[model samples]
Target: MAKAFASQGDMTDKQISFTEVGRDLYAFTAEGDPNSGVIIGDDSVMVVEAQATPRLAQKVIDCIRQVTDKPITHLALTHYHAVRVLGASAYGAGQILMSDAARGMVAERGQEDWDSEFQRFPRLFQGHESIPGLTWPTTSFTGRMSVFLGNRRVDLMQLGRAHTAGDIVIHVPDENVMFTGDIVEYHSACYCGDGYFADWGGTLDAIKSYGVDAIAPGRGDALMGQDMVNTAIENTRDFVHSTYRPAARVAARGGTLKDAWDAVRAECDPKFADYAIYEHCLPFNVARAYDEARGIAHPRIWTAERDMQMWDDLQG
Candidate 1:
C-alpha cells in the first residue's frame, strides 16, 4: 500500500488514490491537479511524470516510499511543460526520458513556455526557487520506445501531433491502461494556445486504437472503466470541436479577436462552466484556435511579455 503526504491550497482539493490498476502498476492522483503514474518493477520504479517542483513531487515520492525501496530509476516526460517537467531533480532518477520533439521544443522555446505556464497557474509552481533550470531529458526517442520493467511491459508511442508537436503516451500492456500526458485531459479545460484542435481530436482517436481499459489522463481523476474512459475522450473531443467551430466561423467572417472570443464563450462557457481552469484557458484557447483556423499549423511561442499582451488584449 502507498501513502501520500497532503498539501493545502485554494482549490481545497486533495486526493491520494494508490489504486492498483494492474499487478504492479499504480496511479497517484491529486484530484484533477496533476496525476502521476508509478510503475513498480521487481527491482526499481519508473515515475512517469515528475510534478512541477521537487517539493510538490516529494508528496508523491513520500507515497512511493511506503510501498517499495526500489530506487526511482527512470523519469519520463510526456511533453515540455514547466508545470510538468521542471521538478526533475527531486525524483533524482538515474535517467530522464522524452521524445526528440520534446527536446527540440526545449531547445527552441522552453524558457518562454516556463514563463507562460507560470503565469497561467501560480499554485502549481509553489516553490519558484526550487526549479534549478528547465528540465531536459538525458535520453530522447524520436517516435516510440518499448521497455520492460521486471515482468511489466511499457509501450511508449507518439501517435500524432495534438498537445504539442511531440507527445507520447505510456501504455501498460497487462493493465491496458494508457498514461496520456496532456494529450487527453479529463474534465479540465484543454489549453489550446499551443494545441491543434483538429489534430488533437485525431490524436484522441489514435489513443483509443490501443484498446485501453482505463486511462490516467493529464488532468482530472483517472478513468476507471472503458465506459468512463470513453466519456472522457468524448468530452475532450466535444470541447475541442465546440471551441474551434465558432472561432473558425468568426475568423472567416473577419471578426475581431474579441468577437471571436465572444462567439466561442457563448458556446463553450455554459457547457464547460464546471470544468477546471475554464476561465484561465478560455482566452488563450480562443486566440490559438482562431489562428489555427487561419492556417497557422504551429502555434506562436508564448513569452512573458507576449503572454501579458495577449491576456490584456483578450481578457480585458
Candidate 2:
C-alpha cells in the first residue's frame, strides 16, 4: 500500500459536545466523529446510534447521566455499520432494535465489516478488546416500529435506502425532532462505501417530508430550528449528488475506476475537500458510485483485504 487510509492516521481525540435538540432530547457529537442521540421519556430513556467502542459509548452514557438518572431501556441502531453497532454491550439495554434488512446485513457481512473498519481506523475502536462481538438486535422490524418510554413515543421508520440498505430514522412526534443516523450528515462527509446512490435521494426526500423542527444528524453539529435543519438536508443532498454525478458520467463512457476517481475529485474537491473524512471516504465512495452506475444494485461487501486492494488500485 502506498499510504494508509486517512482515518488510520487520525489519532487525535475529538472534543465531545452534548447538545439539547429538544426538551429531554440530546445529541452527542464529537468534532466530526460518529454521533449518538438521547431521548429521555417519562420513565426510561432511548439511545440512538451507539459509538464505535465501549469506551466511546461510556462518553455518551456519562452525558446522559448528567441530565437524567433514568435507565436506558431501548437502544436503537439506524443501520449495521461496525462503527455504530459494535458498542452495544456498553448500553446493556434489554431491547436493542434494528431494521430487518440491517439485521440481515449483520448476518451476511458483520464480521468482515468489523475487521475492515478496525483496520482502517484504530482510533474509533479505542477499546476493541472490550467489544463482545458483532452487535445483534434483540428485536427487528420490517418498515416501522414504535416504542414508548412510558408516555413519550419514539417512532423508528425505514424512510428509504441511503447510507445503507436498511437506514432508519428515529422521530419524536411531540417535539418534532428526528435522530437521523448517517442518512443525513451536517458538515461531515457521508460514508457512501455501502450506500445506495440511486435510492439515496428519495430517502432524503422522505426525511425532508417530515419538516422536523430539530434534527440530531449523524455527524457534525446538532441541527436546531427549521432553517438549520433544511440547510443540512440540502447540503447532504448536494454532497451525494456531487459525488455520484461525475462518477456516473465516467462509468457511462465505460471509463476506468481511476478515471471515475479523477472526475469525482474534480467535482467534489472544491466543495468538500475540507469536510471531515472526505479523503478517507473518497476512494470507497467513488468505487461504490462507479459500481452502482454500472448496474450493481447491491453494495459489495467490504472486507479488510478488499479495503487495501481497492486503495492500492486507486492509488496506482
Candidate 3:
C-alpha cells in the first residue's frame, strides 16, 4: 500500500519528556518528534537544536524554566533542517551558533527547506507564523569552537558530515555527555534526505571515539550508560548501512529508484519497521542513497513539489 505523504498524516501530539542526563544537563524529547538538549552552566544556559516553531520552543522553554531560571545565553543549531533550527528566535539567545557550512546551507536552500518541511510536517510546524524568516546564525565557526558558560566548557565540533553536510555535536567534556543532533538518532529513523550516506558510518565511528557516557540523540529518549551509548551508535551505523548498501548495490546494476527503494525496504523493514519515522523517511533515504551510490556528490534540493513528485513515483 502507498504510504502517507511525509509526516502529513501524523497529527497526534506526542508525550514530551524532560530528563536530566547529567549534572545540569537535560534532554527535552517528544516521543518521535524533534528533540532539544539543555545545558545549564554555572551562570547561564545553552540550548541545542530548537524545535520547529516558536510555540513548540516555548514548550521547551517551559521545561527549562522548571529546571532553572538561568537565562538562555547560547543557542546552537546542530544543522540547518527546518524542524531543528527554525524555532531559534524563541530562545532569545545572545549568540546563535552553527558551523560555517550550516550557514552556507541556510543561505543556499533555507527558504526551500522551510517551505518543503512545513508542508511535509505540518504538525511540527505548530506556530509557523511565529518564525521570523530564516534563522541565521549570529556566530559561525569552522572546524571547532569552544563556548564557555561561566566555568563550564561546551565544545561544538564538526566531526564529519552525516545527516547533513553541516552537522555538529555539542560535547560537554567534563560530563562526557554529547548531544549529537540528527547525526545519531536513538530508536529513531535517520532522515537521510540531505545526508551523505557514504560518510555517515565513519561519522558514527568518529562519534563513538568520544566514549560518551550519555547521549541526547536528535529524537527518541536520551541514551545513558556506555553500553547504551555504544548500542545507539552501532544501531545508527547499522541503519545507515542497511539503507545505503542495498540502494548502492541496486544503483550499481543501473536499477531504477523504485528498485533501490524496494531493496532498502526489504533489508530494513524487518529490523527497523517499528522505529519512529521509519515509514516517513524511507523514500527520501532511498532516493539519496541511490543518488550517492550513482555518484551524485551533493543532494538535490527538496522542494515541496519535488517531494510530492518523488512520493507519487516511489511510494505510490
Evaluated with TM-score, which candidate comes out highest? 2
In the range 9-66, model 3's lDDT, one tens digit per residue, is: 9899999999999999999998889999999999999999989899999999999999
Model 3 / residue 104 / CA error / Å:
0.1
Model 2's TM-score against the true structure: 0.99
TM-score of every candidate relative to the true structure: 0.94, 0.99, 0.98
The CA lDDT of each predicted structure is: 0.83, 0.94, 0.93
Estimate, for each residue in 148-192, the C-alpha lDDT of model 1 and write its tens digit: 778877788888888788789999888788899888888887877
Off by over 4 Å in 3: 1-3
Q: Provide the lDDT at 161 for model 1.
A: 85
In TM-score terms, candidate 1 sits at 0.94
Query: What TM-score should be assigned to candidate 3?
Result: 0.98
Question: Candidate 1, which ten residues in sequence have the lowest lDDT sum?
Answer: 1-10
Better of 1 and 2 by TM-score: 2
Better of 1 and 3 by TM-score: 3
Clashing pairs in 1: none
Ranking by lDDT: 2, 3, 1
C-alpha lDDT of residue 227 in model 2: 96
Q: Candidate 2 residues 1-316, lDDT tens each?
A: 8999999999999999999999999999997899999999999999998888898899999999999999998999999999999998998899999999999999999999999999998999998899988899999999899999988989999999999998999999999999999999988999999999889989989999999999999999999999999999999999999999999999999999999999999999999999988998899999999999999999999999999999999989
Report the C-alpha displacement of residue 281, candidate 3, in angstroms.
0.4
